[model samples]
Target: MERLQKVIAHAGVASRRKAEQLIVEGKVKVNGKVVKELGIKVGENDRVEVEGIPLEREEPVYLLLYKPSGVISAVKDDKDRKVVTDFIPYIKQRIYPVGRLDYDTSGILLLTNDGEFANALMHPRYEVEKTYVAKVKGVPSRESIKILERGVVLEDGKTAPAKVKVISFDKRKQTTILEITIHEGRNRQVRRMLEAIEHPVLKLKREQYAFLTLSGLSTGDSRELSPHEVKQLRALVLHGKNRA
Candidate 1:
């Protein structure tokens, strides 16, 4: 269930504020009764109409995309750069990225039309795990690795403790591949954390989000999430879990 105004807005009737105005003006009805109250909620079975026209609610869609570097993680970009939505033109619903990925970063991304689901996953209290594999400029010292695992101070604040592991290292190139998992979703956080350790990121890619991964998907490919997967995610957030 959702607020009537929000429901109307999600149905593409009008914006939420406009929906409120229409409701107060008696232009909106639920189950054949004019509703003027803003707090009124409607469920799936509820019949809603605006200005005597039946409202058509869009069914929610959940998709996982292997977002390639350079593609904007937005509905549209002001500079007209290609966006994640452009890759899935076959989908009709106005879905959006659950969270953003940097233009220079690539990998697992989720997009959905269900605002509640997105909010639940994004809420700080949920502590949803996000894993990233990064190739950095140099091999970090044990002290730097410890600093990352213990939480590093950033411009924003001290980040929560992370799960960090050195995946591999190239002696000749002086680069190290590391896997770091964290719950926070700060902008360019992985890069910032590496910078804080004096090992700036050379390249980065998200490996996992919560339990979701880019197992079969390739770059720029996407697939609709199964009903069970969606249910599992909702349950994961609802039950809460330890911070990464």
Candidate 2:
């Protein structure tokens, strides 16, 4: 048995903090009896309801979304702008984004109801690699490439070393597309790194994170991860420390 608030939170009804409030408000019930105690225990066999609607234990859900440009990576937007959750109308679990993507950037984004899994993927200690394809204003000089390989100083401080490679160059357009791999998830790291090298990024899209990819997924579309995919992700989080 577990605390009612924790059980509700684990079932994705709400966060643990919010669930406690609901219990105090006397809006939650177990086995047809109103339960207002914050520390009340609940078992898997117990029936739970909130606001008269029966609640079921939520199964873990993991999804990959090809987030399009102009959408914020949040569950709710106070500004009323489009959010990543808008594309996932069918997901029943109260999941949240694993990490953030800039409003103008596009590509692979992971969403899950498993907080432990999300923490593992987002934590820098795991050092999960995120790959991005960036279209920059101009080709970076050899020295600049070395600077990036070693590490470049952003406005904040020196960034961690990143793997940079020229994917292709468009001479006529005066643009160069580069593939960059970084382990840190600092805000706008790719764009800032390119700016530091005097080559402003025109477009950026994350293509992969660790073992997850955007392959077979289209922009603005989302799909539940397969069982194998979910298992692989959990393993990545649990064993990432050892691997690192």
Candidate 3:
């Protein structure tokens, strides 16, 4: 048995906090009866609904999207721009982005309906690494790369050690392509780090998250994770938790 709001949240109707608000607003009903109290417990036999739509059965969905530049990473954008959810319109169960990707950035993005799974991946203590390919204004010297490898001081504080690899350099454009991998999720950390060294990022794309990659995806395309992939991700999250 589970608390009514918890069951509703597991059903993907809304977040737990929002589900509690629905109950308080008299918008939740169970088995043809309105339920306004927060203390009520429910079982599998109960029929739960918000407004008039019956709650969906709990089904954890894991998706990988090749995010295209110009779309917001959130479920919705107040600025009226396209959002990540627009790609999965056929999916009825509510899902949310595991982390964030800026509007101008594009790459591998994970979304899931399982809150615990999402939390495990995003938690700072888990130290899950994210790899980004940054195209910057100039070729970085070995000393500059070493500076990044050691740590760069940002406005928030000094960054943790990062892995930096010079992928290539273009003479015509006078730009360099770099592979920078870090475990931190600070806002615009990659862009900020490059700027501090006098090289501003021209474009940024995340190439990998943990062991997951955007190998089979194209811009704006999405697909459900295979069973094997799901198992691998859960194992990684569990392993991270144990280490923490």
Candidate 4:
């Protein structure tokens, strides 16, 4: 069963908010009866109609879109900037990003229409790891890496300890490539962490999330999640709950 407004929006009639307004106006009918209640739930065989027209049900969609830097991570950007949704024009479902990516950061991003799966993935207890490869202004010494591993003080609070490894150093360019992984999703965290250590980031890109990797995916491309991949992701979230 699903919320009437959600089902209506899923049929591409209108957004969820608009659907709610339509319901309040008594324009929605289910099983040949008007339903004005906001909390109403309709089961799979229920006959749902909006303005006497039947709604078409679409299967849930899960997709991975390589978010390019400068694209906003929102369903619709008020600034008229391009959004991640623009990258997947072929998909018709009202899918949303699971979490978020910075407007200046690029890499692996997950989009889905399944609210339960998104909740499971974003829920703090899951401790899903997000990994990034960062190019910094200068090489970080062992002491600095240790400090990042211990956690840094931010405006909100101290961040969770992160795993940091120096991938390479280029003396000529006075830069270092570091692979940093953290379980917490803070705003501009990787760049902030590097800046806190006096080695500002030149470039940053998320390479992995949980067990999912951006293998062979160039920025701006997207693909549907395979059934097995979806199963594994759900299992990971459920296992986290079991442990809790």
Best by TM-score: 1
Q: For residues 164-212, could you state the per-residue lDDT of candidate 3 as single tens digits?
A: 9898999888999999999888888899999989899999999999888
Residue 174 displacement in candidate 3 (angstroms)? 1.8
TM-score per prediction, in order, is 0.83, 0.79, 0.80, 0.80
Greater TM-score among 1 and 2 belongs to 1
**Cα lDDT tens digits for candidate 4, 1-244:** 8899888766656667778988999999999999999999998899988888887777878899899999998889888999999999998888899889999899999998765577668776877889999999987889999999999888888888999988999999899999999988878888888999999988889999888899878999999999999999989888888987
* Clash pairs for candidate 1: none
Better of 1 and 2 by lDDT: 1
- Name the runs in model 2 displaced over 4 angstroms: 1-57
Given candidate 1, what's the lDDT at residue 118? 76
In candidate 1, what residue range of length 10 has the lowest lDDT sum?
9-18
List of clashing residue pairs for candidate 2: none
Q: Where in model 1 is the C-alpha error above 4 Å?
A: 1-39, 43-56, 241-244
What's model 3's TM-score?
Answer: 0.80
lDDT of 2 by residue, 32-115 (tens): 999998878988899999889898777888889999999999999999999999999998778899889999999999998865
